[model samples]
Target: MEPGNQTHVSDFLLMEVTDDPELKPLLFSLFLSMYMVTILGNLLIILAVSSDPHLHTPMYFFLCNLSLADICLSTTTVPKMLVNIQAQNQHISYTGCIAQVCFVLVFIGFESCLLAVMAYDRYVAICHPLRYTVIMTPWLCVLLILVLLLLSTGDALLHGLVLSQLSFCRDREIPHFFCELDQVIKLACSDTFIYTILIFFVVGLYGVVPLCGVIFSYTQIVSSVLRIPTVGGRYKAFSTCGSHLSVVSLFYGTGFGVYISSAVTDSSRKTAVASMMYIVVPQMMNPFIYSLRNRDMKGAFRKLISRITSL
Candidate 1:
């Protein structure tokens, strides 16, 4: 197997990023629309958090971070997909492929950690109201986000380095839409056992660990909410968590469903469709989920509109 050299790899064919040739125009329009909404929705959340003095709190602080992460997450994949589909050029250079995978890893991994942080933030705010201010101080929130960023960056760099070691001989056509690590590694002609094992550990670290954190935090939150004597108090606590829980459930549900379907099912078509639900579909759904369900954000948005009209 030849090592990764400039002499080889004129280009890599990306198979069926969009299947139906006649439908390509429709898909391009649809994805382009979704991309626009994803950007605008996330940006509005960031702006609402920043501009609203009423939202100058730890909860909103963490929410803005989530919005930023989602923006990065969606942009890392969708825009590239759009460009590839539009230009009919899916051949990313070696450097570009690595860079894309690195970001895809960073944002998705960071989001997993960020969700845990946000869960803990909700727990502290609800369970220990008196100590919420002390527990989730502004510095502490920033510290958590910074930690997520550092860890995610390191993780992505590791993935890129590991992938670089594998020799992409003869077959370079990726089956999936984006430069997914799993799909790319499958294309490697060299022995990829070490890389495969490394992926298992990394998946566990980035997926399971953060999921555990979210579970533990929510468990404590439920316990605290259960202790609330008044119906109104219970309702209020649950309401605060409702939007977050919905988003979390949607994110994890679609993602886990894809994994399970892909693993157990024999059909590649089924797996591919599931992948779109988890990855492609979520970019549009996230903003809608948050905006429609989150009252604070909706109110903040209304305030924004009013302010704009006043201008």
Candidate 2:
């Protein structure tokens, strides 16, 4: 390998959704709108949770963090894609690509772990109602967020380091809108056997562990819900975690859809559409899901809007 070839490529050409001149404006407008909505929606959730005294509980705290993570996750890729579409340029610089990878990993990791943490919080609230306050202390919540940050940061750094070491071939065109880790890895001309195995290990460790935690938490919750004497009691208990569960399903469902669809079909465009659902759709839907399904969130937002209107 030549020493010059070993250096990171100056930029990578991102896959455009469509090549039609007429469609460029449509795509740009659509993505820009979605990005704006994602940002505004998640920000509102954070504000509502922060401003409302009643929403200062462990559940809402976790929710606020999740909203922040959603904002970061969308911001990581959508804005850049929108910019590229508007500018008629798909070239993302090497440094920018690496930054996108890091931020995306951190935000997604935060979301996954945060969802699991929220599940445990719900379990305690429903199952161990008496000790919910004591168990989910303010310090504990902060500590949990800190741990999530540390873990996400570590994982992202490891991924970035591994990716930086991988040399790309002459074809630096990534088959997706964003600098997706897997797609970038696939573009590597150099041997990626070890890195591939490492990624699988990391994916399993992060994906399985949190998913298992969520499953276990829900199992306990269901057991407790079933033991409730009244149907209304069960309903109330189930509703407490309903929003989180819905968000979790959307997140994982789209994620798996992207993975499975990419594997089954060789159509990069189809895969990119699926990836949009994975990366963009859930973030857009999360605020709506939480606010609509969770009465507390609705009340908080209602109050927030009323106060802003009065001002």
Candidate 3:
């Protein structure tokens, strides 16, 4: 059969995370558990932040959005994998695959942008405490979120449209559990030069820029904290940033690991496994990192739970 454009494509086969039939049940259970944890954990963060009037600041506002994004990002991938595992059918419809690609990009892009926003929030709170409320007004915060959503959705749609144009040969098996953009592109028989360029552009615009923002924000934060003179003051200021810093490290560290693994290793399976580190682990850990390290979050959660129990 001749290579056909995406229009003629009916579906693509998603490769299982593991090949062992014996391990299928284990893998299914494991992923299901993780998905549930990710959803519930992130939901709790949102509820805690929203329900508590004390938590209605810009930082917690962004935290709520971040939790929402994590929930979305995880939802974009995990549920399909669970369904495939249970059905013992790794086939994903072409439309479903394209939709997955679009959403994965959108949510991940939103997360990158949101993290940078959160970093700026910390910078304002620590470095310019007096003007923080003025600078990060409610309107400004909402505008930032709206702008990030536009940027994320626009980029995702562009990539999805470009991807839809590419033709594929008979080999339609994606080595990853879901329609990871890069993996899907690799299977295209058509020239992907434009798509490749767009990927790099989006990466720079969404990925590197946010990372730079986080770094700059933290740099100023450290400088301002150092000027506090008193050790307790310094410690207290730095503590506010600890949770965000941990999350930034986890997000970027695993992300870079995926890039490095994909670049250096010839094994697609290994690359897929590395992708899991970035995709699965951080979403599961973010709620814990924030709720445990953050006194406000812990108190909010307690209140939220008590309220729920009483209801």
In the range 1-311, model 3's lDDT, one tens digit per residue, is: 45555536799999887778899999989989998999999999999999999999999999999999999999889888888988889999999999999999999999998999999999999988999999999999999999999999998998888888888777789988889998889888888887789889889999999999999999999888889989999999999999999999999999999999999999988988888768899999999999999999999999999998999
Reference-based lDDT, each prediction: 0.81, 0.90, 0.91
lDDT of prediction 3: 0.91
Q: Which ten residues in a row have the lowest lDDT in candidate 3?
A: 1-10
Better of 1 and 2 by TM-score: 2
Winner on lDDT between 1 and 3 is: 3
Tens digits of per-residue lDDT for model 1, 4-52: 5332455565556566778888888997888788788888888887888
Candidate 2: residue 230 Cα off by (Å): 0.8
Q: Give me the displacement of residue 287 in model 2, in angstroms.
A: 0.4
RMSD of 1: 2.4
Q: List candidate 1 stretches off by more than 4 Å.
A: 1-10
Reference-based TM-score of each model: 0.93, 0.97, 0.97
Cα lDDT of candidate 1 equals 0.81
Clashing pairs in 1: none
- Candidate 3 stretches with Cα past 4 Å from truth are 1-7
